[model samples]
Target: MMIFEKVKSAIDMKTVAEGYGLHIDRGGMTLCPFHNEKTPSAKIYGDNFHCFGCGEHHDVIGFTQKLFQLNKPIDFVKKLNTDSGLNIDIEKTPTKTDISEYQKRVNEQKTYREYEKNAWQILCDYLWLMREWKKRIPASPDDDLDGRFVYALHHFDYAE
Candidate 1:
């Protein structure tokens, strides 16, 4: 149960291999650093990882030893846990990257709100201009200035 919790705490799988100076590719897979490898044969799963080339399959502890060439798995695990600052929260929230994405969405929403506000202001200005123009123009018998102003205001209210 302790190992399980430790493994769970070590969420970043790349941290193990990176500690050993091994580079993981963008796909979260890396070439077998245990031996010379022409192509990447390591497969990183959500809970565990395995290297097809060297047949190295273990939990976080096993991974640290093989990757770091250490004699003791426990020492490797402890060192890695401490070095990487493993967060062992039972009820962990999403990472800062997720929060940054949410912030980006909020900024986009604010941009849209500003656009909507500008559009509403333009529409109100256009209505005011039309009312002034109507007053200056000679009114025909059929022209109803009161009715037009009421209709435009009603439309603006509905937009809000």
Candidate 2:
């Protein structure tokens, strides 16, 4: 396998960020080292980082390169290997089973991420609908309140 591929496959960005003294919260966010900010804007994924505030985006090696002001990616790779003790065998060739396992892992991660995003979006939409329902008050004292409003009253807090 190539050095770049081997390095990326072995080392996760969270480890790199943590090793460099960046504290990642439960949401995988940290105060961006690239810029000064009161709140954490950089989202660290397994492979990369994206800063919502400054529009800075980079993969693991790119991040390390920028963080250290290195001239070349190879230099960053070397640092990652030697300093981080990743111990990725740069010249090792992947077997068929190794390739299949890696692909399977990648696919599973992609599927899980998609499911998580979809679920979060669905919950947010449901919350909004419940809030809208709660606003539907009856105009007359004798009239019955909207059932949706009652449902919202019962479930909004719990759902939230």
Candidate 3:
């Protein structure tokens, strides 16, 4: 979906841009981010915003991606369209580049998710085994008696 379409359909363009640190003032105009400016020459016209200071104007999706230096404009568009109540028509057909990149991302994300799931399962199984072993074998005097075993396990597993 085009950013223009998304922005034009949404009502809270200025609020959304402000949430991204654009600092809209004087009816959604702010200092241009593309160039150094003391005065606010930027203007937001309904869904689209423009900066006369640097002559940069685009829809909210473009503004968001440029402001945050996102890698993909599509990613930002998808996010904004999904989160900010901007409805978009689904593409009837996908292009080759879109299909290929989406497939690659699906494969990578699947592998990563599977790895995480397996790792979590392994830890859970290990904890069950440990609990069983502990039931079978009484705690020793030298064993650290603090109930921090689960906390330590969680910290080690998820503290990325």
Candidate 4:
């Protein structure tokens, strides 16, 4: 079994949350920590938790990671092993291939972000030009330029 499966089998999310001092009711409900709520909106299941108030959902490992701000999954696993006295073996060092793949994914995300930024800028500029044209163009019922401009503006407004 993988490390994730081992951790999941070893840890109960409800117990972990209780260890953090969050009061969980017998019905498996608690006040959501991620958001402000008068009533219990976070529900804990056998393997995971979901908050209806903030929509925060995660397994046991993810719960600990978010709660303690651990940087990586391995870090969380190590912490869990230490705290729970589990003998799950995990590699302490990542391979070169792993580092390369991580860097590639990071680069791809950066490129996608740049593309989205440029696309939004272009859309905003086009919307501005359409507004300026609407101001300069005279109101003519026969010509549908005004109507088309209005439609374009509405489309871009929602798209942005």
Which candidate order results from sorting by TM-score in descending order? 2, 4, 1, 3
Instruction: Tell me the TM-score of each prediction against the true structure.
Output: 0.45, 0.56, 0.43, 0.51
Worst 10 residues of 2 by lDDT: 101-110
lDDT of 3 by residue, 41-143 (tens): 9887766778777788777777777776777767777666554433343343345564455445435644675698699898887667555444443268777
> What are the per-residue Cα lDDT tens digits for candidate 2 across 29-130?
999999999999999998899899999999888988999999987889888766555544456777667656655654565567569869999999999999
53-154: candidate 1 lDDT, tens digit per residue: 878787666676666677865666666555544533324454656445534544564467569869989988876765554454336757755755555555
How big is the positional error of residue 11 in model 4, measured in Å on the Cα after superposition?
Answer: 1.6
Evaluated against the true structure, the overall lDDT of model 4 is 0.71
Candidate 2 stretches greater than 4 Å from native: 89-160
**Candidate 2 TM-score, C-alpha based:** 0.56
Tens digits of per-residue lDDT for model 4 on 53-144? 89999888988888788998889877865664444456534455544553454456446756986998998897777666546443676665
User: Model 4: how large is the Cα RMSD against the reference?
Assistant: 13.1
Clashing pairs in 4: none
Candidate 1 lDDT at 66 equals: 65
User: The CA-based lDDT of model 3 is what?
Assistant: 0.61
Clashing residue pairs, backbone N/CA/C < 3 A, model 3: none
